[model samples]
Target chain A: MRYSGFRVIAEALTGHKGWKPVWRDPAPQAEYDYIIVGGGGHGLATAYYLAKEFKQARIAVLEKGYLGGGNVGRNTTIIRSNYLLEGNEPFYEFSLKLWEGLEQDFNYNAMVSQRGIINLIHTDAQRDAFTRRGNGMILNGADAEMLNRDQVRALYPFLNFDNARFPIKGALMQRRGGTVRHDAVAWGYARGADMRGVDLIQNCEVTGMRIENGRIRGVETSRGFIGAKKVGVAVAGSSSKVMAHAGMRLPIESHVLQAFVSEGLKPFINGVMTFGAGHFYVSQSDKGGLVFGGDIDGYNSYAQRGNLPVIEDVAEGGMALMPAIGRARLLRTWGGIMDMSMDGSPIIDKTHVEGLYFNGGWCYGGFKATPASGWCFAHLLAKDEPHKTATAYRFDRFLKGLMIDEKGQGAQPNLH
Target chain B: MIINHPILGPRDAQEFVYLGDANLMGRPDGMTAGIEAFHDYLYNRDNPAGAHRELWYHEQGDRSWLVVTRNTVTHEILKVEMARDVARAGGRSK
Candidate 1:
């Protein structure tokens, strides 16, 4: 049912029992025209776009667990398009645009907050690099601003600006970059897709792919066999394991990345901020908890838990950046598996298996690229062509030595 | 996590730096192998969820490279061997 102020007032005047389940829990059909594996945010968004934009019918999204049980719920909920590469900036800018119109498009309260995000600068070299990155973002039609040391100090006076070493010099700000209620994204997309007659089947684990003589046929699942003429694999951390069912190996490794949230406090942090000298980024949630995270655990693992060393390192980075949060008790911490690609960028292209597509290798940045990733993947699955912004994400880029190494860290996934 | 270093007996895992799969040590002969082989060696991985044999460098301890066969699911170390020995056993020569 359409939710509006009048409906809410009417329901309030009555017994207030007009609310219903957002999405249906339908059983999987025997066959569908399109089958999307892993009903995370990207998969659900792809199904929604396929039904709404492409006007395709007979779409099914298979989830091993319930929706929002994966990275869609595990991320720290930051979104930004402040990238410096040609292959990445445009795509992320498109995603930022999608984020701006997402709540209206899906008719849900996602709480898309564009408070802004700032990358603190410590060194002159960092300033030069950020200057270049800011130019790149502006060229891609995204907003950017360079804040001097006094301006940053005026904005966030609690920061340790006077540190003898690694003093805060400046900051690169993106006025439109911020966070959204991450789980709401999944629910909104699921409801939109279900409204468009797309089946969302949860608790259906795909065990294997049924490829017949180099062509796609169906998939073997825990429930039973489900036939599909076309299949798109959008599993993030499970990319390697799932694609292996089709006798293909991906240039991806799974590593556990942890995030933390502190106890609730008064409204403090006005925007997302990243430490200049370390890999610590933090933002204050609407509920007042400070949500933050750092580097990956730096090992290959499928487990959704991290060791203590990285925790200590992240806390140290936080303390080094802002000494005021030293006493805030950590409320909880959790981990999510990251599909760290060889070049530290994502891949969204067709595989050698006919009618089977792939979309993964999102490293730690998958949360921010959800909208564009789904839009482009749906375009590919419907039109059999890459989206204009995603033309560089082909699998052959690695074979041709055209890696989109955003951090210029070569082929090391852990470093990225 | 503690790694039973072959020579040092047991060392904190924080003392070592991770370098990913042990398959990286099986470098192909660039003179004979084509770009496909090089690409596979550089990118493709058998990233299993169970036991994974990966390389770790003792940068803070003895600066020795070792291979640790650990379970990715449970983070339990199964065996640890000096990477040099594993390389020699796999028919690598200077």
Candidate 2:
């Protein structure tokens, strides 16, 4: 079943009984050539690309729970390449390009909206900083526009432009950056991989790794022992605990990041907007619910929930940005675990164990970097070398004092 | 989250900044601890799902650091004490 306008019409005429399940729920195989753990966006995307691009077979993705049950489904869904660092800009730009053609490639309706994103500028120094960032984006072959106060006001007149403390001065806009249907990404990649003979084993928790003489043999799971020639661990927040099975401690800490949505209203917000002076970003969904998020809970915990103070803080930021949001009734809030690294950048490299690979420490960038992270991780696994765009994401970078500290916040996972 | 401050009574947790693992306050003598110990001190921690002792700075309050013993699973604060008192009780001087 190829999905298209013709197929939709045919299915409609036939009373819509011809549709099949998106992906199969296959049982675990006795062994596989490659086993990727953590069936979130990155793991599924890696399996899809490994089968599609690298032409690998006998691939299986092991998930502890159902598909799309992780950060892939718990994000704010904003996508952009407006980074300021060389180590990050090109890679994210590549991901943005992948998001542009994702629906066509996966044969799914992902709703990749390029409604643009604006980082509001509140001060003179912020304008200068955004100028440098915009220039960096352009240099990295990504689109960026520095908008003046009038231009920003024209785009989002609801913003509090006359605040005495944090008045809106201008903004840095990227017309190509926007949101995507987050879970659809997971489903599409899972369906594509499954179609290509890749096994997706859900509810199979890996308990331990069977290492022989510093090399990988396979994994010990709750179901049973499954042999594998190569293993890739892409567990997002569980990176530390999962890799601990192999006695490798990562320089990553897990923290809870909360997100919220408002009661559905008439469509108003046309694009994604972030408050410069604070940690608040919001965009309206197609259903008119305002999706937004702020800072993390700022603690080391693996819980998938947050407390009230952070909620109040996020609501304060929203109210400060747009007083009108105060009237909107709150719908709900959720949390995702962020694998914050020492320097706030991700690590995608092989472990000391010969046949084992590790890919995590994504922090806040995991959802946005899904496609490129998978593409680069697959390239590394297939070729045993870092992809050109991801060369800086080496595990040894911190040991060699070559950290890609994008936030310029040193060695603190929580600060990052 | 609300922390019942010892001196200030119940206060919103947002007034504080979280620093993981109250064990971070125990600084080994640099001359005695080797690189391996330092590495373990800096990078390794026991992230349990139950009660955890963490440091929180009252940034919007008295600027005192509090050692908050809370359960990660339930998001419940067990106890809160000034970190300076914890440091002194363990025998230290400035």
Candidate 3:
């Protein structure tokens, strides 16, 4: 049950590495040069890059909940750079590259297991889409492969090869994309950022945005007021609420995304496969748990728990993909809110309000884009220009009707 | 094989009705009935990735209720939880 894909991820993030500090936020701060809201993957990664790349210390990240308690901790922990969009392709490729050296670069165990990610294609049209994504990955210099039905069977040999409904047609394989330990990822970035003089303020919710004369002055948090010249809003779920304080509304709706984990068993799945035909994807964790998830909750809600239909549909898909896993027990399940956007892409751009930037609407792949999101968001925060790769993801695209919705899920997946 | 999932593995499926938004990817209404059919009814169109239907789980861990979003034709699952837990938010369309 060994897959080169799984090994690539395992070595990339979690291959035994040297020890490091157990990252913990000391205390809240009264002032900061840069105030970041939300302490999830994007927030922590942004703080890390701000210090590592921009050489800017004295940065503060304020979180409403525990550090990494947001989407970073709740995601299915899959990583891939198989975007077909013009901008998302290279940005995600960069993220995959960043994930490769996370352990060595941060000196923390992130458990990045490159179990390989395959998107199943069920038709000629889907195959074409997969090929386009593969080409995009190649253009971005990331590893991508287009696999036919026979090729897929040769690799796993346990798929529902003949299911007429969602035939095991073809797949787009990215050997570099896989899974990472959610908590270790947060700890790694947090430790690295804090070591560089970044302040991580946990349990401190920013209640208000301070803007004066068309410029950001500080953030009003529950603990105290933290002043900064530049303020970045990284809260994915409560984006509208935070941005509303600044008289701005992003093209995002808060939706719940649920995922499930099956009870641990002997090693079975060595790689990850996404049933692109439906919202089904499966990856076996190091603990032998089969982690599965799909499509966001079909409505807008701040609630963390998701509906049951998605769970049933996802489990049924898992059963079809790997008939042998039918006997495996699912252990527990959880849900997280995502700021799904009109285009099903992230909005990492400078807002009309100077000194106030937005980084939300990650749909379902925020975990994979942590590094690149921060990297580009940092570029924008420093120079105040849309990073070249994230240029199309501008907030204005929603208003202009020039949405980059490759998924064709429309503005909302449910309405579509 | 009997899949033993933490949520779905422990229960015996009870009687349920077929309610489909009957979107582009919905399953035909004339498939089958009963537990196996109910299982398919619950997930077939609301899961797998491209499903567009609503599902209701009548029986839970031990007679509790679970509602879900699912697919019918492909039997792919989307969201599953206690009927009470999935956020009961505003009905306004996003």
The lDDT leader among the candidates is 1
- Give me the candidate number with maximum DockQ: 1
Tens-digit lDDT track for model 2 on B1-94? 7899999999988788887889889867799987667666676566665788999999999999999998876788899998989999988763
Model 3 Cα lDDT, one tens digit per residue, A1-416: 12245555766687535333456556866677788888988998899988998888778888898889888889999888888777678788888888998887777778888978888888898888778878877988888898888988888888888887888887888888889998888888888888888888898988888888888889888987888888888888777778877877456656678899999888867888888666688888888888898776564455677657678888887877778988878799888877766667888888777788899878777889998898888878877887777787787675556677867766443422
**Considering only N, C-alpha and C atoms within 3 Å, which residue pairs clash in candidate 1?**
none
Off by over 4 Å in 2: B2-12, B28-40, B43-45, B58-64, B78-94
lDDT of 2 by residue, A339-404 (tens): 988888898999899889999999987998999998998888888898899989977776667888
Mark the regions of model 1 whose C-alpha exceeds 4 Å error after superposition: none
Evaluated at residue A295, the lDDT of candidate 1 is 96
Q: Kindly list the per-residue Cα lDDT of model 1 for residues A189-220, writing each as its tens digit.
A: 99999999999999999999999989999899
Q: Which candidate order results from sorting by lDDT in descending order? A: 1, 2, 3
The number of clashing residue pairs in each candidate reads 0, 2, 53
DockQ for the candidates, in order? 0.89, 0.44, 0.03
lDDT for residue A250 in candidate 2, whole number 0-100: 76
Q: Which ten-residue region of model 1 chain A has the weakest summed lDDT?
A: A273-282
- lDDT values for all models: 0.94, 0.90, 0.73
Report the TM-score of candidate 2, chain A only.
0.99
Q: What is the interface RMSD of each candidate, in Å?
A: 0.6, 2.1, 15.9
